[model samples]
Target: MRTSTTMPPLQALRAFEAVGRLLSFRRAGEELLITQSAVSHHIKQLEEMLGVRLFIRKAKSIELTPEGAAYLERTVEAFRIIAGATSEMRRQTARQRVRVSVLPSFAANWLVSRLADFMLKHPEIEVELEPTLRLEDFASDYADLAIRFGTGRWEGVRAEWLMNEEMSPVVSPALYDDGTRFAEPKELLLQTLLESWNPVGWELWLGEVGVDIRRARVLQLTDYNIVLQAALNGQGVAIGRMHMVRDHLAAGRLLQPFPQIVRSEKIAYWLVMPQNRRLRPGAEAFASWLKEEAASPPSPVC
Candidate 1:
């Protein structure tokens, strides 16, 4: 007695396709992460929309009706064609050059240093790095992949998580010898310049160390890299990301003063690509390589 709508939901079509292909609504539900009844409803809705019975219900098993079999054949062929086209596109794209967008801080601190290795390995795939803080539109934009900070929920784009952010206080060795005893977090703040990327940075670090941030001397800087460099010169104590300051910290250019920790706001780097466009082989390979590199622990120098 159910009536069909002007258009059926693509979800319903997908559910029906799965059920028809598998010939088991229960199995389809398992694959789709829906209850068997939900999968059955989707197929029923599809059947109503198409005005054709898609399956013959049996006591113990389900069988695709004639109409369902025909539809399954076409859908399977469509999927195969799409897969073939995607493969061809990847092959062609891999053969050509690739462009990547990265954050200035990440590029200067991490990626650029190790880029030569990637180039040496992938001689065929040329890569160009475009540094910017602004998010570029990948649909009409020129770059193939963008490294960004966030949960990767941008509209019309696909995102893959790269790494988590870790932060701590860093200062030059000279600052420790300036007769400034940083035995306690609160005492250290009073003696050194509290360089902060944002106002909450000092507060977060203090909170992590069980110190009151309100009593700390806070100095805000828009560019964190500058603050880190300033810290290296013994100008002040800067809260720095461990990933970015790995080399500096290891080189004894910057030293941690407290046993405190600050995790990033779940907005670490991500690899983004256009939703509509299939990843060219070069882009996909580069993205994968970047993820692996980012996840790997930085060298002892870093």
Candidate 2:
């Protein structure tokens, strides 16, 4: 017996494979969008070229012969391998994109303002920003990295210190100019307290200064962004994180009424990524840029 080096036609193989899987020439033709006669013709050509009977034709149905069953198994595996290789190649091509998850307020006040420089530096990389209050799952492909505000400890991930937060009372400069002496922490209670989340920062800061806020008029908001906006509009006084409000204070849009700034030992900004996952080039580049940006002092208020 002589073996042929040349393989059979791809169209004939496809016709046979589809018919073998579906076990019906009519169904394979419907799947392949061809006529049932075309499917039968291709299978007949394939059988004649290979000198083998692949399927037993019946009046209403067809069944694979012994040779057909063995060939179908190999053909299906070959198609599966081709599909897997194609998917892997597509993923490699998309590696230039980096997805970052961050807090809404942080993204609005800090990252958005400075993101342009990073884009300028690495034009090849594309960044996708996802801002949400909920902690993202780094173990999955939800994000390439996350900038979270917390103590630098999380299970199953590597957390690197990004920046420490300092909280201070910020008021619109117009409010400060009204000559309502806010020299004392207790004085803030006289004005509406623009609060975020639990309003715990106000209580923490007041306790540190031995001031009571039991009677303070409060307007609790959903997030820090709204709180800061309320304070900027002179609606109330808000506890502003130093990193978030540095530009506003520097530009004289908002004023720190007192010199006291409180640091939270429990919460700070951190860069988190899954420890077991390797960083792709785009992720690595963004992470490095973030660290360098964090280490530098805030730009002088201009």
Q: Which has the greatest TM-score?
A: 2
- In model 2, state the lDDT of residue 129: 97
Local distance difference test values of all predictions, in order? 0.78, 0.87
- Candidate 2 on 1-302: residue-level lDDT in tens? 55454777778889999999999999999999999999989999899997999999999989999999998999899889999999998876663889999888999999999999999999878999998876766756879999988677778788889988887788898786787777678888789988777676787677788888687887889878999899999998998788999989888899888888788865589998878888888999999999999999887655
Number of the top lDDT candidate:
2
Clashing pairs in 1: 246-302, 247-302
TM-score of 2: 0.65
Candidate 1 residue spans exceeding 4 A from truth: 1-95, 150-156, 191-201, 264-267, 300-302
Which residue segments of model 2 deviate by more than 4 Å? 1-95, 153-157, 177-179, 213-215
TM-score of each: 0.62, 0.65
Candidate 1 residue-wise lDDT, 1-302, digit = tens:
55346756767877977888788888999999999999988888888878999899999888988888998788778778888999988776565778888777788888899889888888888989898766768856689988876556777777878887676787889877887657777776575555544555566667778887777667776566667777877877877777788888788888887767787565367888887888877888888888789878766643
